[model samples]
Target: MSVYTTVSRDSLQQWLQGYALGQLIDFQGIAAGITNTNYFVTTTHGRYVLTLFETLRLDELPYYLSLMSHLARHGVACPAPIADHSDRFASLLAGKPACLVSCLTGTDVSHPTAAQCRAVGEMLAQMHKAGATFPRKMHNPRGPHWWSLTAQQLYPQLPTDIAETLAEEIHFQDGHRFDHLPSGVIHADLFRDNVLLDGDSISGFIDFYYACNDILLYDIAIAVNDWARRDDGELDDELARAFLAGYQSERPLSQAERDCWPVMLRAAALRFWVSRLQDLYQPISGELTYTKDPAAFRQLLLAHRCRSEFWLG
Candidate 1:
């Protein structure tokens, strides 16, 4: 969920049968996400996920659904978009684009271990490598350019002291001082909750709403910032080593990839920091949505800047 989507049971049922798929046996709202609302929809054939898009354009949804179908067809471990009887991937429901996706099997990991971090890194590396050939182009919403725009809109709403500092960071990015990073389709946001696990092994990844074209190293940095960092806002070397080693086992990082890790991680920190602050101050006014603390990543960015090598190793 992107903080702006909602789902209704009646509309879900209507869309399911209207698409000529089948009767929806049962559907319930999934409370774990903060962006678009989701439901685990069960039917006679099988269980599928129904997502009500909140932020994306209706025209852009085909790219998302098509990309999922393509990734699943290519053996990438993710929830594939389930097509309707007409082989249409999407249907208009209550004036919103709603689609069904194949349900991935696994439990979401709330507190991941080092081994899990390594597995996440491995799977994500494979995703990036495979996604290089994914046949669609979607611009990442949290890329530097978008970040600058977000800073402009949200900076004033932040606590007075941090606003100027964030604006300076935005100015620095605008100067083109941090623009030399390889570009590709990236997950952009891969928090531990997004990675599913069965026992000690990773089963699949979910929540592709943030997927887009951006620096590949920045993608890794997003995962590292989320998975390989300790609760005290310090990068865990053991976790980072495990993650990087597992990722390298799939696709080796270029020298450029390695050299850019620190700034990329810092950029990732800034990305989440800005987003979390936006959500914190401008929470969605709705039935059931909670705000996340921006301070988590605020402290994270401070620590990373103060001790760059903490994330370097």
Candidate 2:
């Protein structure tokens, strides 16, 4: 949630008048993420998050907002988009597509414990089940198609070894198919910072901008890659096992999902590696922006390549 566009107090006050929400008490920019401009807005009624779409177009927003509403209504612990007096979820703010969502109660757990990982896993499974009936259909923007294009775009700027690894991985993934696996709406960017914890229990999952329809196992792979990793970029056995146990308690993984886990893990790693490289090389300037290290995910991809055993085992 970087601050790209600045919002003045008067401007925000005028905007809030359209909503039933009371006067804006205070607001501050959030600087933890790299995507959109986010602010923690406090009003006389309650707390909410005001997000200004950076890259996502206005026409492309309904799927995300509607998915959140669908999941929240089905008992998934996620933020609910707040509509204005006119019953519209999105509006123009600072000449950008903007919306308000209820602020969930909790803090992010950076270094989560095994129990916390379990909670996240269970919640993720529930989220998947809740979103299964959602009517919208949107492709995973950072899936294989995007990866191929982004890999080509970054190849000229990357080291030879990195470029070779990316090309080889992309080629392998292009040939492999998991069409038989179950698919649904997935929170593709459920890293630690995106989930909030009240104590050891997960309060809510945030940052649904990357949500899309994809293979369910791929979503699990993305979460496992981030949530079950040790300091050395190796998968933590205890955390991985606990997480899978929790997820299976709700929605069990099919035999195909288990058999294809290794490849899915590698695919998840590649997705982040390419994105981090793009952020590092072609960064967008903002009032408060943070570009994560591309080398971190590069090391992770190499580790996944070398490790043959599934972490969940």
Candidate 3:
């Protein structure tokens, strides 16, 4: 979460008056993510997070807010959006679409242990099951179609080999249809930074802006790619196995999902690679932002291409 919009103390206090959150004691900008303006807000009532939408529209926010509420109610560990005096989840802060959510209790662990990976895996599977009955039907915005378009957009700016690799992968993914696989609302960007941990147990999952309806295996692949990776960008077999085990403890994977795991791994890699490339080439300025390296995901994609069998084993 990055800060694109700045809210003044007086203005923030005035806004806080609209809610029963007591007076705003302190707030600070969060600079770890690339999407949305986020701040750690503290009040006499409790701690919370204030987020201003940087790219999401006002009309398109209900799905995310409602989904979070649904998952939280269903025993998923996630931040629940707080409504205002008018009982509205979305509001305007610094003239941008904004909302507040309860501040999660833990901190993010970058280099997680095997047990931590298991916790995240279990939580993710529970999230998918809880969201299965959610009424919203938003598609994955960074799925294959977006990957194709983004690859084309970035091709001219990249080296020949990188561009060719991206184009080829896009073509291959387009030809492969895993639509029949188990589909549900997925935390599409369940990277290390998006999950919070309280001493090896998952405290909460944050940053649901990228959440959408997608293949369940694809979501697992995304998490595994991030949480079950070694320093060299290769999958850590023990961690991966533990994570899969935890997920299966909740909802077992189908034979079809198993067959498509390798491709789904590559698909997840390609999605992040394209998005990082886009951010690298076409960046939006924010008050506080963190732009990740595109080459990291490029290396990850190549590693997945070469070592597809490693994960399945």
Candidate 4:
């Protein structure tokens, strides 16, 4: 069974006809995402991805569409949405807005190695550099302040340890010490599933829903946390070295970026922890869904805090 929300074949055909994508020969639902309903649509013309907007507002969509277009033009390896015959990217589907994007090749690497992490880091660096001049600025939507408030509301029964950690983090956040760090567009969430690898090299990257105006170094921290670290809670020195080396090969990070890496790592860990805990306690209502363990990131956060000095060395 596919994780994508289902629609009758007739309904799908009707929708395709409206977009002039030709008759739908066959389509398969994509089970890759938890946030949106997705399907790989095959038509007489070619294959494309159909995405039904989930949590994003209609007003918030142009940022993603524009971002994708910008990245595609700037030599970024990512999917670009295809416009319909009428030059419209969105259409109503089952009473919700939906859009189509060209299907990108390459497999999603579940267990990426250190070399792959390096490629991803390089790509991320290039992505941030290109997006630095992005004209339209949008909020992170999942920043620490937002997560703190969500923690108070959703996880009111959070364990004492977790609650205390959150309180301390909030206190530090109030000082706005990190505000002076380099700021730019950031892909706040880029888990393993969001990145695709061809052999040991990254072939493509997807899922721009979390792209927003934030610290560029924080984006690197998120990638390192997911791509360069392992489940046993140890940061692989080779992975970190390879990844950072690759990033510096492209758009080199400034001294400020390096200096703030540890704090950014801590912030990244907490953001994921809050979201995972939200899913664990108040699971979203859906037919096919999987919840991530907040404990995993909590342990990772602790580990990073213990090795806080290594970041400088």
Candidate 5:
């Protein structure tokens, strides 16, 4: 139900003329994501995905498109952007910025195994490695500044308990600025739905919309927050450890990263807590949009606050 802006066959066929892709056979709306409108497109030649931007502006699109292309070329399994006749991957489509990308295989896992978590960790590390060489840079848009600003907007309407919890966490994060840790391009959002598994290995990582330059550990924390979370909102130690093991296999963490582990974990939790709360309160009007439950992240944030430090071995 994520198709916000509908596209008819005729308009899509005309748009396809800008590329070398053959005649369109069929297209179906993908009902998985929450941010943008996505469709699985089939042509005589091959299958692809068409994403119509909902909130992102055209000027800020090149960084994401280029990052995906950069990652794909460097042996990272990600959707490669398809360049049109003019060597452009993005264009105005149905009055919105749109682009077509190579569609990948595999289903989003519900209950991920330690092995699967390991694979995701490996891919994320690989992405970070590849992203380091990318000349362009975009700082994390939802970093601490966003957490504070968004919290201010939420306080007036939020319950006192939630507001107090958010304020305390934000203040705590302000004390530690992880500037010295490893910095590079990070997929700020790496939840289960953003990953697809084929057998024991990962088919690929999808959704690079939130990719940006930041402390590498933050990316790991974000992934662990979602991928390693359990039914009752507690972390699965086995899975989280497996994920960290897989990542370390590719790129080892520094002592500084280890020291800041708990802070990074709580930073990741508070970020999503504020976001999910915003989505719950000031929801955007979309014909097909999915709003996740804020309760899980809230519970997770509370759980994280109880732990003072995290051990990385």
Candidate 6:
């Protein structure tokens, strides 16, 4: 129940009148990611997801809604935002921005197999390809600027070793520039829970709220960091290889992408490390909030720092 705004059945039913969707059959608060309030919205028409944006404003939502529409139209397995009768993807609900999206099949895998990793990689590559044609662009709010700002805020609260690592990693990342890399729209937060699987096939890539323009390789790195991660927070070799193999099968990585592989990996790790720290130390009160352990990504970042060459080589 990461529900910040509770919607009663009567209010929700009233909202459904705006959409062509039949009467709201049932709806329940979803306990998934902490960023927004979600509900499993089932109507006489179909099963869909209802999201109430906790932080993002109404006008700031078109890019994401439009992007999802674009990706879905291009055959990407993701939620497609449902436009209301007025052809608007978003409207105010419970005094917050809200939208509905077609729900896809399948549950998220906790421990993905090599095949699932490969499927996820292939899906990501497809998303990247489709995103190339997406006209509009939005800044990655959780990009480097966010990393530095969050690190500064967490420094005083962090343990000695963690703080030192954060400082060193931030300094290291500041020196590297990704301006020359292939840039495109990316699903910046493609954690395991964000991807859904139906049997052996990928049903959808959900939670596109973190989507933005960035180095294409960084998106792959984000996916690999989560999909190919082992229990000890180290890269699982076989799974990593399968993932990259699947991605390259769709779109071969440019030499520049390969050359900067390690950087992206470490950068990806550091990003999550800082975010997890924020979630742990400054958690917001919610009906049901799920915060991950910050130490997992912290350990992974350290391991990545120790690597001299790409392990996948």
* Runs with alpha carbons beyond 4 Å of true place in candidate 5: 284-289, 308-311
Residues 40-101, candidate 6, lDDT per residue (tens digit)? 99999999999999888999999999999999999999999999999999999888999999
What's model 1's TM-score?
A: 0.86
Writing each residue's lDDT as its tens digit, candidate 4 over 138-159 gives 8887886688688788646887
Query: In model 4, what lDDT does residue 191 have?
Result: 78
| Model 5 TM-score, all chains together | 0.94
lDDT digits (tens) for residues 1-313 of candidate 1: 4424455677667677655547778877776676575778888778888887766666878877787777788777888887777788877766677788888788887667778888888888878878878888987766777778778888667777789768766665565443566677788778888888886677778888778887888888888888877777667888888888888888887776777676667788888888777777766676344667777776777666666453333
Candidate achieving higher lDDT, 2 or 4: 2
Please report, as a residue range, the 10-residue window in candidate 5 with the lowest summed lDDT.
304-313
Better of 1 and 6 by lDDT: 6
Best by TM-score: 5
RMSD of 6: 2.1
RMSD of 1: 3.2
In order of appearance, the predictions have TM-scores of 0.86, 0.92, 0.92, 0.90, 0.94, 0.92
**Model with the higher TM-score, candidate 1 or 3:** 3
Top candidate on lDDT is: 6
Greater-lDDT candidate between 2 and 3: 2
Candidate 2: residue pairs that collide: 1-33
Candidate 3 residue-wise lDDT, 1-313, digit = tens: 3566898999889998889899889999987666687888999999998988977888889999989989988989999999889988898878888899988888998788989988998899999899889998897777777888878778889989889888888887887889889999998989898999999888999888888898999999999988987877767888998888888888888889888888888898888888888888877565234567878777878777777454443
lDDT of 6: 0.89
Off by over 4 Å in 4: 1-4, 18-23, 154-156, 284-289, 308-313
What is candidate 2's local distance difference test score?
0.88
- Order of the predicted models by lDDT, top scorer first: 6, 5, 2, 3, 4, 1
lDDT of 2 by residue, 1-313 (tens): 3688899999999999999999999999987667788899999999999999888788889999999988888989989999889888898999999999999999987678989999999999999999889999998878788889988888898889989988988998887888899999999998998899999877899989889999999999899898998877778888888788888889988788988888898899889988888888777675234677877777877887888667554
Residue-level lDDT of model 5, residues 1-313, one tens digit each, is 7888999999999999999999999999998877899999999989999999988888889999999999999989889999999899899899999999999989999789999998998888998888889999897879899989999988999989888888888899999999989999998999998998897788888899888899999999999999888887888888898899889999988889998888899899888888889888878665334577888887887888786435355
Error of 3 at 167 (Å): 2.4
Clash totals in order = 5, 1, 1, 0, 0, 1
